[model samples]
Target: MPKKKKITPKQETALRCLQQNFDKRAELAPSSDDVHATISKSSPVDIDVDADELEKNIATLSINNGNTRIRYILCLDIEATFDGDKSFSHETHEVIELPCILADIKEGKIIDEFHTFVKPSLHPQLTNECIALTGITQVDVDNAPTFREAIQLLDGFMKKHSDKLHPPPQIGSPPPNGWPNLGPRNYVWVTDGHADIERFLCLRSCRINRVRLPAYISGGYIDMKLLFKTHFKERGFRRLPDMLAKWGLSFEGREHSGLQDARQVARIMLFMVQMEAVQLKCNRSIVMEMNLSFAARQL
Candidate 1:
């Protein structure tokens, strides 16, 4: 095994602050209703915690601040080929773009990114609708690696950042039963919705490409849309742009561009954590059976 990487002093301070806040929050509140109160009092800032400006300021804090303790959130968003129809099946679609933003939990900013365009074996040609919606051209996919190759590159990126990750389970240990049973993980994947992981990666891409979905990916992920809805107690938003509009923020780039979407999702997640003190956790996981069928569990 490789030696663990050393964390910077700033990172150490941020991790300590986060651990203290989480511990205090757990001690102060036994119910969800009192969480905000606990967070407000436990915040490192000495101002009105409810103020939006304060929350934004907290987001910029780099050195101030998990079991199953998260050090990073891997924000991923995929753009796939579509016929411009809502009734399309996952079986018929193929991921054309893969992008990820690795956000440091304590720093509240993206520390790194991984991106690639995937050439689909099933549908090598992009439909006009898909091209228009995603702005991904045929040349992009033609010049890109295959799904398997792209995933291999992604795995390498994750390994490069392994020092920031939580230790994996022992080789002989029983597979994780649930969130509580699972030991500490340094990071968790976050997506705008379950489709990216559930329908795209697990159900479609892996099966189509004869690739085994990495355990790190299939283990679980956070559905950011669901988290936001539950946290704000509002269900009015239907898409990422809508979510941004609610916060008086506009989408920064092309709507369906994978990297841009992932960045926006990271932004929203940071805002929720720094401003609202919402604890991010894995809310979804895949259960793979002997027969290879997948059952997505909502945790």
Candidate 2:
């Protein structure tokens, strides 16, 4: 047998942290009822879906992925304002709601969540069509944070979980499976589609607000839609509800509501990993090349 590799001090610390977290998962894991209650209390609108049904579906879909390499997944979704039917452009629209769920892939549970509504700088007033579609009222945006402030808060949230979010470097070669050993960097961002990062976060919001996009946010992401199509050998992009239906699961909360949508995406991810044994990886990315000196001058 090959000699065992020695763990460095840094790796030892990370291992200790992981062990402690796992030990406390029993205390940290919230019951399905508690989760539903929390969402209901936090959301502005009432959810009409049956809580028992939703819990049952989640329980049915939750399966252990013994082959999963990653430790965590960050499921993200955004709701934005738009023009009725004229056209679609990231530049024209604005992100109105930002939400994300952090999940422990092996345990198949959402450990934490973050959410906020963003007030549009350009289009301060909500279009009637946008209101009807997203169910976000003018009053909601009025009380929300600006895009810059929202991004800052998001960055802080990521920092708060830095150990999990940014894993330490691996000291040796990757495993024989041809997949890189992610070391402490053991998480990937998951989204229903690419628009959340490519169009909204990187292109529109950061540019309009004159904020430098966080490196982690732009690094890369797993496009769940693409993964589903590839893994199941399906064609074309499907909506979140449709995707959930594939697993006999109904969406739990208000459609298009950022937090609800994010949670649903997390559920789909769990199903894919647990039921289908899909290995999650970054399927899409955006290349952001910025001239820091010039950018600093402009700022």
Best by TM-score: 1
- The digit string of per-residue lDDT tens for model 1 on 1-299 reads 12223555664555455445433432432221221122221112111122122112221111111224567888999998877777876666888888877878677666777778888988899988889989999998997777766766666667668778664421111233422233346677889888887788767776777665554565556889888789767756558777655545567678888977887888777756765568877777654332335667677
Predicted candidate 2 versus true structure: per-residue lDDT over 1-299, tens digit per residue: 12223555664454445435433532453433332222221112111221112111211111123343577888889988788866775556788988878888787667887777788988899899889988889988897777766765566557658777544321111123322323224677788878787677656766666554544444446788888888867776688878877755567679988777888888778767766668766666543333211111000
* lDDT score, candidate 2, position 249: 52
Q: Which 10 successive residues of model 1 have the least lDDT summed?
A: 40-49
List TM-score per model, in order. Answer: 0.72, 0.69
RMSD of 2: 16.4
lDDT of 2: 0.62
Residue 150 of model 2, lDDT score: 71
